[model samples]
Target: MKIAVMGAGALGGYFGGRLAAAGQEVTLIARGAHLAAIRERGLKILSPRGNLHVPAIPATDDPATVGPVDVIMFMVKNYDVESGARAIAPMLGPETMVVTCQNGVSAHERLGAIIGAGRVVPGVARIPADVPEPGVINHSAMWDTLVFGEADGQVTARVEGFRDAIVAAGATAVLPGNILHDLWRKFVSQATLASMTALTRLDLGPLRTNPDSRALFTAAMEETERVGRVAVPDLPGELVRKEWEILETLPDTMHASMLDDLNAGKRLEVDYLSGDVVRLGRKHGVPTPIHEVFLAALRPFKDGDPAGLAKDAVQEFRTRT
Candidate 1:
């Protein structure tokens, strides 16, 4: 199948490169120096499992120049959500499937507004990946497991085709019966960790090891899980506990992509993740003091000193709660 990766950053590069390596017709939409590098030297993937340099893959910055493809892995950053979606809309054919491998709860809906709901698939990616350098993706420590499903929870040919393609690309695919539930479950797990690590300026390895920090992390997780439950009532209550325990088992140095964005001075996903928690809380009349506070603290860094922003956020969270 012809697959076009919209972002081509760490997440897109890792997954798209894998597909390209497996002989799929993959095109990476990129810009500036990264686009140049990929065009000149091929797409380079430095994964924990291995490494590769895709020599003949197509890389471009303009989506209009590229024709419609069978699938599009929409992996753009949170900041470029709409713009990216808009840019890729013209490239989608009637039968094209656009998979959103992004953070936040309503990504599928948000993109659906621009690309039509029938062609949208909500996806949740579980991996630590980022572009350590332009044209180079560093696949960090985590299983390259992906879960996605059709918007209406109906298993369709497009969904199954995506599953087969992903598996052929050498990653795990979770074809959940209910994609929304699966996506929300991952959001609960990721939102808690991203906020805690970015705020504390510590990796999960150290943060989970500290008594006070661990407690705070758990509290945040508990609060987020509470918010998620109210937002998604169908989610079982005990699932949060399992999510927490599973997170505890990951490598301590594990930092959410938000933390990486914080350190790099790039825009963070606080608004969609924890910030969404606060928004939903207000909508449901649920008290979300923790999430609200974290949003306030992280706002300063989301723009400029996001690294220091996270530090201050943690300190303030520690002091207040």
Candidate 2:
């Protein structure tokens, strides 16, 4: 299979590297220092399952250079979806499938509007991975899975073919009966973890072990589930429980990608995660107090802490104590 990873960051790099190592034709769409590192050396995967290095993998900033592929893993950050969609036009053939692996549920609609809905496949990436440095992907947990399907839940040949390819690459993939429910379920899980970890600057260890913090995390999950149900009414009533079960299985060091961005002083995905929950809650007349607080607290840091106000406040409080 010919595959192109549009973002080719942590998530994309890890999976795309796996596919490439397994003899699939994979091209990385990346830029900046990361692209430079890939071109200079190769893409490296630091994973518990196994370490992989795909030397001489085709990588470029321009999609036109790679031409069309069987599948395009659209893994850009939530904020860059529109521009990313516009940029991938040159790589879209008649039968190419664009799989969106973003954190929120809105990418399907946004990408559909730009590139035609028929070609879009909504997907949820369940993995704890990040790029601690250029050309390096740190898979924080042993769990790595991709759940995706057609918008209407049909078991098309292309979907199954991609699933087989992913399994062949040693990663799990699922074709859910209803992709919308899976998308919302992932949203509930991601939004809660992202907001809490970024707000507290802690990992799953402290958040899950501390009773008060764990309760607060549960409350945030409930808030997100409420809003999610409003969007997808047929969502399971035990969605919160399901998410909690998944959380318990994660390693102690697991944290959201948003927390990584926050620590790196890069732009955060606040508008898409917690901010989206608040916006949808208002539109559907649902109360989302927890997410509202998260939205307000993190909004200032959305574009990053350029003024260093957050750092100054922390230092001042430490000195006072």
Candidate 3:
């Protein structure tokens, strides 16, 4: 299969590199020093499963450079969904499939609005990886899985073929009975972890170990489940408990990507994670006080700390004078 990995940071780099190693014709779309490093020294994957170095993977910053592809792995940050979709428009063919492996639930719909819904496939990424430096991906966890399916829940040939390609690349891939439900399940846990970790400025070990923090985490997840049930009525009522169970199984050092962004002084995805929960809660008439606090506290850092802090400092000096 010919695949294009749009936004070749962390998640995209690791998975796309693995697929290329498995004999798929893969091209990575990236920018800045990372793109330059990939072009010069190739992409490197350091993982507990195994270390891989694809010395000559094709990579470029512009999607137009690599014409139409069989599959486009749309893995940009949640905020970049619309622009990324527009950027990749020139690479879409009649039979091309664009699979979104983003955090929030609205990515597929946002992409579907630009490109046709038929061309978009909803997917969930279960790997914990990060780009420690340019062109180098550090995969921490052992479980690497990609679960995706058609928007209409059909077991189509394209879906099956993509699953085969992913599995052959040595990653777990599956077509769930209901892809929307799976997305919601992922959101329930992700929003909870991202909110608590970012707000408290701690990792899962500290958050899950303390009784008060754990209760807050549980409440946030419960609120997300309440909103999810109204938005997706078919969602199981026991989803909150199931998510808590999954949370307990995670390694103590685990933390959400939003926390990583916060530590790096980069823009936060709180709007899409916890903020999405707050938005849906309003739409469904569900109360989400916990998530509301999460959004309010994190909104200042949503666009990163630069503009907001500079503006605040100027205002303070003027007021004192």
Residue 222, model 2: lDDT of: 88
Candidate 1 lDDT tens digits, 1-321: 999999988888888899999999999998888899998889888877788889878999999988999999999877678899889966888889899988978777888888788888999888877777888988876488888998678888888988998898887787898877777777776877888888876788888778888787777777777777777788766767778777867876788878767866677788888888888889888888888888988877666563464456656867998
Superpose all Cα atoms of candidate 2 onto the true structure and report the RMSD in Å to 1 decimal.
2.0
Model 1 CA RMSD to the hidden true structure, in angstroms: 4.0
Q: What is the lDDT of candidate 2?
A: 0.90
Candidate 2 has what TM-score?
0.94
Query: Candidate 3, residues 113-141: lDDT per residue as tens digits?
Result: 99989999999998889999999999987
lDDT of 3: 0.91
Report how far residue 281 has shifted in candidate 3, in Å: 0.9
Q: Candidate 2: minimum summed lDDT over ten consecutive residues — where?
A: 309-318
Q: lDDT of each prediction vs. the true structure?
A: 0.82, 0.90, 0.91
lDDT string, candidate 2, 1-321, tens digits: 999999999999989999999999999999999999999999999999898888899999999888888999999998899999999999999999999998888888889999999999999998878888999998866788999999988999999999999999998899999999998887887898999999998889899999999998899888889888888888877888998998998878888888877766789999999999999999999999999999899998999886876666656866998
